[model samples]
Structure formats: C-alpha cells, structure tokens
Target: MKLYKTYEDLPKIKLPKGQEVSISDSTLRDGAQMPGIVLKVDHKVKIYEYLHNIGIEKLETFVYNDRDRNAISMMLDRGYEFPEVTGWARAATSDIDLVLDIGAIEETGILMSVSDVHIFDKMGLPSREAAEEKYLDALQYAVDHGLRTRAHIEDMTRADNTNFVYPMIKKILEIDPKCTIRLCDTIGFGIPFVDVEEPFGIPEMVRHVKEELKAVNIETHCHDDFGLAVANSIAGYWHGANWSNVTFLGIGERAGNAELEKLLLFLERRIEGFDKYDLKSLFEFAKFMEREIGIRIPRNKSIVGNNVFAHESGIHTAGVIKNPFTYEPYPPEVVGGKRAFLIGDSSGIEVLRFKVEDTLHDLLDVKISVEKNDPRLRAIQADIQNLYNNEKRVSCISDEEIQAYVEKYFLFEPIVEKSMGRKTL
Candidate 1:
C-alpha cells in the first residue's frame, strides 16, 4: 500500500470533469421532521462539526424558531467552517431576517410550491398567476435583503413545468440571476429512468429546465415515497443538476430524502474528482444517528446497512472467502464496516473448513485438518443436516454446537485395521 501526497498523485476515480455536484445536508431540518427522530440543541453542535470535518459543503438548519437559531449560533461559535451552514425557510423576508440576524447563515432555502395541488388546493389562490405572484413577492423581498437564496420549488414533480414552472423561472431570473432554484420531488413522485416526460420523470425534467427553462444553478431534492430517492437524485445529477439535497440516513417526512451516504458512494464511483467526500466517516455517522435519534438502522440498508456487508448464504460465503469482491460491490472496510459471515442450514463443507481454519485456528491454537472426502467431516455434516432436516430444528446450528462437535471428534484417535480393506485415519 502507498499514500499520495496530493490529489494529482492519486489515481483518477471519478465520473468526469464538469459533472461534479455539491451536497447540501438536510438532516437537521427535513430529516428532523421524521416521526420519531428528534435532536436537541446540543446534538447540533457535534453534528455540525461531524459534517464539517467530513467535507460536507452545506448543512440545512431551521430558522423558524429560537431553539434552532441558538443552536446554529453555538455551532458557528465552535469555529467549524467547511460546511457553510444554511437555514430552511419560507420564501419571505422575515424568515430570511430571522436567520441572517443570528449571523450564522449566508444563504437560505425558501419553499416555492409549484404543483397545482399546493397552488389551488392548499393556498386557495385564484389561479397559477396568483400563486406565482405570491412566491414572486416573497422572492423579491428575499433578494432585496441581500441574502443568498435557494428557491426550492416544492412539489415540482407534480407540476407542469411548461405552464406553471417556466413562468416562475423567468420571473425569478429577472428578479436576480444569482438566486439558485431547487427542484423538489415533494412526494417522491420522481422516476429515474429516461424516455419519459415531465410530471415526475427527473431526467427529462432536469434536461428541460437546463435547455428550455433556462434555469441557472439547478438543485435536486427528492423524497423516498417510491424508494427511488437515490436513483432520482443520480438521474438529476447526470442531467446537469448542480446540487443534491440529502439527509443523513434518508430520514425525513413520509418516506424520506435521498441518503447522503448512498449518494456519496455512487458519486465516488462514477464522478471523477468527486473524492473529497469523506467516505469512512459515513459508518460512524450512521451509528451516531442511530444512537442519538433512537432509530435502529435497517440491516439491509445500502452502504451503511448492518447486513450490507454481512454474508451468510453458503455460495456467497464460499465466494467471499476467496475474494470479498466476488460477493460485494465494495470492501466493507471502505465504509468502516466489518465483514461478517454467518453459518446456517445452507452451510457447505468448504464454509465449515473456512470457519474452523480461518476463525478457530487463531483463537483455539489448534489445527483441525480434514480432506474433502474425510469420513469425520461427513459425520459432522450429517449431524448438522440432521439437525435441520431430520430433527425438525427451525434454527441454524450455533458455533458452540460445531465447536463442541469438533472438539469431541478431534479427541478420538484414528486407528482402523479390520473395519476397512485398507488402514484408515
């Protein structure tokens, strides 16, 4: 193994130039809205430092109240600078003032609901023109206040970009070319695949905004209603999205937001020069979130999942025993996770040998050598199989069972003369 002094000295392992996307963490805001997930003011300080040191470019904080405002202030006073902190707010000057007065955030994200459902059904506005005017008024107020703004078009996937969204973009650009607009998939209504049109397909919508809508500095914000948040985010990235809005573990309202870990893992693989993201801290972050938020991580969650690196199937264990890459896309250590193997009813003989030779040799300081057709190995395997099949056992045999069996069998001296045609050991 070797270390590189500079990024130039390292191997090129990114998607490509000009396709790099920035990350804006939404854990403290939208993620906090998760039903049972809650974080106090003190937690924000550590979380902020954690995100900053890991090179996360931005963190979304809440400017709606004093608790969040004071927390943001304390976090800033800690002098962590990498993650330029931003606050989530409505598209209004008062909210922006509330955040800016704390002297913490230089930028803020404002919600601009674009879907007809929000425009008519929710806001009770006369028409799209009325709703557009309402958001424009708020945008104008934000722009006049000299605060950098991220106009999040909420429920974007459920709206007609041509009729409703395009006009808003034109108005926004006229208001100020510096304002960054976020395309929000409010209900996880986005589809990742191509050969599709607007009303939820992200690829076509992303391209449309860039080419036709002439929107500048587009951001991608997706939900996990259909379990396509990560996929939708990647699609937006490939289609010229400049930013990916994410949460720590995809924890948010309803389904959730795109997972920061999943997005970074994919970006690390496909996008060149996208290596600045601290991948190793991800596992710790996941664990910390689980402990602090009181939500257990699902065993099969991607990248940071408990069982993402756990192998148990006989065939999978055998392949992984030879090479981890045979059964995994990336090494468990890459994410600071340990590779684990579980022996069960589907266990094979090679797995048994691997378990004993690889694990027991170091612990017991005893070597148990057995051939492929060894009668002792067959007897042990028969017992294991009988436990599951013949004896009606529901669970797999434990390591203690195998260990006791092996210890007893090894104690028996091999000496045969009359039982077989040849002497056997």
Candidate 2:
C-alpha cells in the first residue's frame, strides 16, 4: 500500500516544535527584472491579485519609482491580511527612506553583499569591514524608524562564514533580536546534500543560522543558475529555515529563482498546514503569466504545463483509461488541470473508444457502451494507422477529426434528431 519509501537511516527533516513553514513571493520584483520583461502597474495589480488569492504569505516588491509605489498602494488598498506587502532595498539610508515613504510596509529586505567578490569587485568597497559597517548603519536606521527588516545576505553560499557571515549576523542580532535573515543563493551555488560542508551545503548553512546563531526567522532566496534553486530552498527548510522565497514561473534575472508553483505543489503533498492554499488557481495563474504577461511556459514544465496530464502512448492511455492514478502522480483537478487522452500514432483502441463515448456524451447527452472488439473501433484504428504509416502524419488527431470518424462509423440518428430539437433514443 506504500506509494513511496525512503531509507530510515537517512537524516530526517523534522521541523522544530512551534516552527511553521511559509512561502514568500518575489515575482513582481525579481521576476519582473528578467530582460525584456516589463510589468506595468496594471499587470502588477493583476499578478498581486493572483498571488493573494492563492494564499501567499508575503510579497516583496520594489518601491524606487512612482510605478512601484502606486502598485504597492493599490495592492495595499485591498487590505489582505495574509500576504503582508514588503519592500526590497539596498543597504543604504536613501533606499531605506524610499521604503519608509511607502508608509504601510512594516518590513523590508535590506540587501547586504557578503562575498568578497561582491564587496570588492561589484561594489568596489575598500574592505569587508567597511561593507559591514555600511549595512549595519542602514539596518540601524530602519530599526530606529520602527520598521522590522529582513537582512538579505547576498552571495551567502560563497561568503566567508566564519569571518564575515557569522560575525555580521551576530551584529545584526545585537541591533534587532527579531530581524529576519534571508540567505541569498545569488548564483545557485548551494548544494542540497547533507554530507557537504559550509559555503555550498544549504542544509549545513541553515542549521548553523537556526541552531548556532539562534536567528528567530530565516528565509532562503535562491537563484537557478545550476537548475537547483528549488532543491536548495527545500534543503534550507528541511534543515530549519522557516520561509522559502520564490517567484512564479521562476522568472527572474538570468536562469530565474525557485518556481512558486513547483515549490507549493511539493509542500502541499509532503507537508501539512498547506491545505488552506487555493492550489487549483495555479493553472489559471500560469496561463495568465503566459497569455497576459507574455511569458512562454514550456509545454513540458512541471505542475502547470499543458502536457503534464496528457496521455498519448498506447500503454499510458490504456492504463489511464482504466485508472487515472496508474499514470498520474496526482489528479489534474487538484491544480485546476484536466486529464486529456490524445489520439495519435501511439494511441490504442481503448483511447479511441473512450474519446467516442466522451464525445457522444458531450454532443447528445447520452451514454453508449463501446466494446473493445467492435468492428467500428478496428476500422477507425486502421485508418489512423494508415495515415501515420502512409501519409506521414505527425500530429495527434484533433477532437474534430475524431468526431468526424465517430459520425462516419456509428449510426447517429440520435445526434441528428437531438440537433433538430427532438427527443431521440
């Protein structure tokens, strides 16, 4: 009866008592930063509504310009209690002031570049000490203004944990005991393996932050440079971090951040307390991102992709026709997706029969039994095979083509009479 099994000797990821998991979205800020992607105020509002409706806990956005400010204000006007709107700013007094001017956001992410590469090369800072002082000054200003801060330690996976990372965090704790710490995997260099050491081991880093440094709140903001953003974020949570930062469709700078839908689906299945989220809205949200937002979602993308629930192979279609769970990890309706049985070169007779029955029910509101050995079924299968074998057909047969075949093979007096507005058997 077991659907899955794992080794009992492996290190288990049990959440500490009184600790709960939450997802924070950065779609509008980081996701919008993808090259050639521009989200106007209206688009921002619509995306905000989608995230809110899905029960996202927090949403971080930029407030440097009037457009960003107006979007934040419009979203705040709705008065949603779950997704507490937050702001992202560099570790500077001016950036902090911009967030403070927004007035209502109680928390903001203060970016602190920790790695020598960032401090020395990217920022051209004279020394690590100077960088630390600058960040602490900005953090102190935010705390003095009565605003809670999330100290986003940029390039954390590549930073010097002993000299820079730990000492800087200790200093931040001295300023505000309750300040949230966000570990940024800016280059997706973090590894999820438990056996790995610091700098790259995500689990080791999170454990050190939670257990050793005794940080109250920790968030994992990861990128997808190595295609391991979601894995690393989950590792952070499993090792003790509470918040998982994500962007819908994983759209962000370069390869993007952790995908919101993928992470949510994983949490929904593996963890408790996530059932309250409207998981069904994820499909619509993906479509909205693709259509209105002009993002092209790959057909094979996980969770919300069009092909996730589609079956065309003979064996797959037959198994699914008998029992959907045979081929699907979960029901499509769980995420507002539909199971589609596609007819193509790989399709079997069972799929053809099911499509005909389904089409009949749709057209005439009647249920007809279609047996496997029916001559009509064999004839239709022959024609389909001939097209693919002889005519070099490359695409799946559409529903319209299937319906035409059904009409040609089966006597449809009932369909004709029903279309004529008369009751028929």
Candidate 3:
C-alpha cells in the first residue's frame, strides 16, 4: 500500500461553490408526516441518538399536532440529543402556542405554505401580502418568546417567484437574519438539469434565496416528485445552501424526501472531508431501521443493498478479488459490508478453486481433483448447486430426511469404498 499527500489528479468541479453542507435529519418530523409511518417514543430516541452519532446533529421530530407533539416532548425529556429536539408548526401564533405548550418553542421550527397555490388555494388567502403579514407576525411572535426560529417555505418551486417567493423571504430575514430558512421543493418540482436549466435549477433557487435574503443559513427540503431530489440537494449544497432535510429510505408524502442512507453515502464519497460521517455505523443504523421499524430497504437502493457489492461475472469477480477498487467505487469494508461472489455459469475455474480451497482449507485432509469440464463433476456440481439454488423452495425437507438419507449416504459413500477392502482396479 502507498500513501500520497496531494491529490493532483483528482476531479475538479466546474460549478461555483456554495456554503458548507450540513445534514438535517427529518426521519422523525417530516418522515413521520409520511402516511402510515410512526415510531414509538423509545424508537424515536434511538433513531435520534443514532442520527447524532453519525454526525447529523440537527433533528426535526414532528409537527405541532397534539398526539405527536406529546410524544416528541416525552422523547426530548428522555434526553434525546442533537442540535435540538424541534417540532414543526404552521406559521400561526396558535401553532406556535402548541409548540410552547409542548415546551418546544425555544427549540422549534415554523412551517408555512409560501407558494402561491398554498397561500391562495390552500389557505384561502387572497394574495402574497396577506400571507407575508401572517408569516412575519408568527416569526416575530416566536422570536419574542425566546425561541430559536426556523421557517419552512413550502413548495418554493411552484410558488410565484417574483410576487410570493421573494417577498416572503424578505420578511422572514427582516425578523430574524439568522433564522434558518428552508427552501422546500414540495411536490418535488425542482429537477437538476433536464427539467430546469443551469443557474436557475433547484440549487440556483437555494443560492438565490441565500444571497437575496442574506440570511445567515439556508436549508433545502426537497421531494422526489421528478426523481431529482438527491441531485437537487447536492446542487443546493454546491450553490451555498448548508442545511438539508432528509428522511430514511427517502420515505415521505409522495415519492419521499431524500433517502438518508443514500444521502449520507453520496456525501461521504463526493464531498471532501466527509470522512466525519460514520459510514459503517450509518449502514448498521439503516439495517436496524429495517428490522425495528419494519421498513425494508429496497434491494436496488444505493449504499446498503445486498447486491450493492455482490458480483457474479468472471471479469468483475476477478477484478474485485484482485482489488475491490477495480470494480467498486469504494471498499465495502468501509461501510461494514463485505464483497460477495455469486457463482453460476459465469464463474471461471479460478473462482471455483478459490471458493473450494477457502471452504476446505482446514476441514479436508486430502487434496481433491475436480475438473472444470468433466461431465461427472459437472453433474455432481449441478446437483449440489440445486441445494443452494432451491434454498427458498426446499423448506419441506425434514431433519429426519437429512438423518435418514443425506447424512447416511453422502458421508458414508467414500468411507464405504475404503472399508470394503477393495484393491486397486
């Protein structure tokens, strides 16, 4: 192995850089907003601690609804740590009162529908002026009450940029210049390059808001309506937005928020100095989510999939065996995962030898001769292979069957020949 102090040949980015990228996990808040998804109090604490452990310090637990708010407080009082245990709320004093009742206003976020459709149609408000006044009032109210404020500008993509979007941002910054502003692509309308042109895409929107408002920090809350949530989030980071709201497995309202597992994996690889993210623990935490929360990770999902490191083709397997970096972007060991070889028609003789030698190295006392092309060996191999291939189907085979047929015949065949006292033929 060799080490280098400089990365002279590393790839360079062409886009103008933005702010420091920070992850804000919403596995509890916005994720719970997900239909049919709920975490018990204890489970929420575990997840909260887990996210913090993996270098995600900011956490959003839930909206200001009564049942959920009580649960969040219980978890918070139980000593959940991170940036803070914050609850989400509508941009109304009544909603802020709900957060105060739960003892969370000082550690809360206020979410308002800032887009034209939400302001006009959803809230039945006449115009952006009315919504701006309401938002400013609620933000100032929270601030006056000694609360650290965060505002969600929901559905920024569909909002009327000139009329509703710009003015809303202006008012919020006027109230709290350091207030964390979330540019939500609610309904997932912000695509990276295809649906939107450069310097005006989702990333551009975040950048524009940050610069226009001169807000201390900006956050991105993207949806996957157009399958560009992850791309948009990265672009947001590149363009100076630091914070992002993400959910595990990308689970949320429609398609989902950015998948936390995939999101962290992307950052660990693409962003410099991201080794701070506990890559291995993140995957383990993801597995725990699947086991405890009952949400299974998709097989083709990035980072932690069973097949993410599995190989079967001769060329690929050989390259992986020689050096995992040959075929894999990053070593599986870094993520507490191991590379796997699935032997089938594509396997070459070397792979078979490697597997056989590894398995039989200490168990077998004598060397065994097996031919790659020999018909007899192939038949026995095929027969053995069925046992593995039909593992899912042959559950009906009983212990009695193994004892009466398999153990007796298979184990005794070779010994029987030796004991028969048969001389050389």
Candidate 4:
C-alpha cells in the first residue's frame, strides 16, 4: 500500500521508496538500562532468541563485563545470521577496547554526544571541537581495528546540525564510508511533522542527513518521553532513514523507546515486504516479557493488550456479534489474540449468547442452534444483570460464572440431542 487510507481528502503520509526498512532491537542494551531492571545472561539469551524468532535484523548489547560477553558468546554460537549481535560503547578508545576484547562482534555503535547540553554539561568537554575530535578519534580507532561502526549521535534533537552535526558526520563518513549514522532522539524532543524546524522536527533532520550529508546508512533511535517515539521513527523512515532502533516493549531509560511490536505491526500493515515477520509471535513475546522479566503489560496497551479485542459495552457487543469489524480494527487472530465477550454491567444479551455458544463448543464439542430471542438466553442474561442491578456487583462477571449460568439454563441433554444428535451437553 502506498498510503494508509483514512479519507480521500485528508492528507496521507506517503511511504518512502528506494530503501528497504529494517528493525534493530536495543532490548538487551538500552532496554536493560531502565531503572530497577537487571537482565541476567539467561534472560538476555532468551530475549535474543525471541527477537530472532520474530525476525529482528540486528540487536545491540553491552560488552563491559563478563556477563555481557558470555551472553554475546552464547547468542553468536547459535549461528543465526539475521540478528547480527552488535556492541554499544561510549566515544572512547577504552570502551572500543572492551568491544574488541570480545573478539567476535564485527560492528559496534560508537556514542558521540553531539548536543552542547551533553558535550558540555554531561561530558564536561572544553569545546565542541574537542568533542568532535574525541568522537572522530574513537571512530578511527574502531575502523582501524576492522570493526564496522554505527556513529550514534546522542541528543541529536538538541544539536546544531549545520556546524556540529553535519561536519562531524561528514568526518565520520570520511573515516569509514560504510559507517551507519544513528540519530538518537535522546530525551525525546523530536516532532514528526516535517514543517517544524530542526531541534524538534525528525523528518527535517533525517532529510538533511540523507539528502545533504549523503549518509548511506541511517538509523533512527527515538525515546518515548513525548509518546512520539513510534511516530518519529516512522517519520524518519518515511523521510529516508532505513533502520529503526527499537526495544521489545519500549523498555528503556525514563519513558522508554519505540516499541518493537508496535513498529512491526505498523510496518506490516502500511508497508510492503514486511509481511515476513511472524506477527503472531508478538503476543507471545509480550507475555514472555511479563512472565520472565516482570514487566507488566497494560490491559489497554495496543496490539498485544488484553482488552484490545474485548467487547463489554452493550452497543459494542451487539454490533460485534453481528460483524466484528464494527468494533475491531483488525482480526484478533492476526496477532495471536482471541476475541473475548466480557460480561459486565454494560454488557447486553448478545454477550451472553456468545459466551454460551463458545463455552458449549469448547467444553462439550456440540453446537445447538438457538434463536436470539430464546427465553433460556434471556434468563441467563437476567441472572447476570441481577448481580449488578440488585447485588451491587463491582467487578466483571467471570467466565466460570457464565459457564455455570449456561449449564444451569441451557444445557438440557434432550434439547441438545434433538438439535444435533448429541447424547451429552
């Protein structure tokens, strides 16, 4: 699809061509940097395998300690070619040596704080020229050691692109023509609109990098402080950047980064050649993150959330019972999620009928044609409504309660046998 259709007259975001978009995960590195989170080697390995199975192209990790090195070694030994294990380091020769000591990683992201805020306030550098020299020297050292480099311009959203950003990237390309430029929207000041100027506009920044600086490979690494990480990342791709740096659940420092599952779903639906990813694995991976890593998935979170496909309101359930498209944006099965008719205070008789049918089919493997106006269905609905109307219930009716009601009112063996020739309910 060239454009995601919303309305014929409304402006649509045009999809960029001539460059295929690829996803690079930072779950093992940046994601682990979230406060109060520590991923052991086993957790890292399992997360790596999960990312590989979900078709991630690359994953960046730290190599500062033996635990990090051992995780890299185990993942590399698996011989998977897609998610090439890469390294992350500060723009220092000592950090470069840490990556080199691993002796297996071929590429590493060299962090260069481009903004004056980071260069001066964070690193306490004397001048922008000194910061540029230090970053360039480190890039040279990495290239000299036969390691492909990704120049991670930290805090690019707040940097001066004309004098500092462009000149430094130009020199980085001069040092290694094949170097990848990763525009880090550190602290998430990036805006997706192209009309906005630099220091805020992600599209303008990406365009300058691709069109002006002539960088061959560009990656967009965004944060979610403004809740625009995915939007800014997509904006970068639409403008020209080919690589999207993401984490599994957008887990990173502060507000986290662009979510891998959210971006994958967007690319799968909006762009071509992204259908190769196993979208079903998204729900499984979210569950794994929640179960193993103790990261709670919000019930209302998009794509893999529990309530994304659930219908509880009376009008919604009624419409969904007729046609699920009336309430759902996409099929629940598309992401390994199931359609649920949750019984609650606002639910209607349609939900009761659906629950009865589903329970019967699942438990007894029998189907009985029941009319929508059947008294048995109404009675079951009344029983549920009574819990709220008279009993002052505050929680949603559970499936076990619905099953009991269905069994009590509708599970007549004679009626079931007469309808479907089944001897059991």
TM-score of each: 0.87, 0.93, 0.81, 0.92
Candidate 2 residue lDDT tens string, 1-425? 44432222223234444368899999998999999788999999998898888899999999999999999989999988968899999998999999999889999999999999999999999999999999999999999998989999999999998778998999999999998899999999999889788789898898888888999999999999999999998888888888999999999999999999988887776565547577888899899888888899988899989999999998999988887767887789878999898999989888888998888787778998888887777888999999999967989999999988888877552223336566779
lDDT of 4 by residue, 1-425 (tens): 45533322223234765578799999999999999788999999999888888788999999999999999999998998869999999989999999998887899999999899898998999999999999999999999999999999999999998878888898899899889999999999999997899788998888888888899899999999999999999998989999999999999999999999889888876565457687877888889889888898899999989999988998999988887767777778778898888999998777777788888887788886567798788888887788898978998989998778777876652234336555776
Q: Which stretches of candidate 2 lie over 4 Å from their true place?
A: 1-18, 412-425
- lDDT tens readout by residue for model 1, 225-244: 99999999888887888888
Collision count for each candidate, in order = 6, 0, 4, 0
Q: Of models 2 and 4, which has the larger TM-score?
A: 2
Which lDDT tens digits does candidate 3 get at residues 1-425? 45432232344343356346778888887776667667776777678767767778687765545556665666667564554677677888887787777654366678778776788788999877888788889899998887888888888787776666777788788888888988888887786653364323685676568777687788888898788888878777777787878887787887888877777877776665565677677667778878888777876666787778877667887777776667787778667787766566455544544444433433455555534564433443455456657664333223233233323333344233336665797
- Worst window of 10 by summed lDDT in candidate 2: 4-13
Q: After superposition, how far is residue 231 of candidate 3 from its true place, in Å?
A: 0.3
Clashing pairs in 4: none
lDDT of each: 0.79, 0.88, 0.70, 0.88
Error of 4 at 297 (Å): 0.8
lDDT (Cα) of model 2: 0.88
lDDT pick, better of 1 and 3? 1
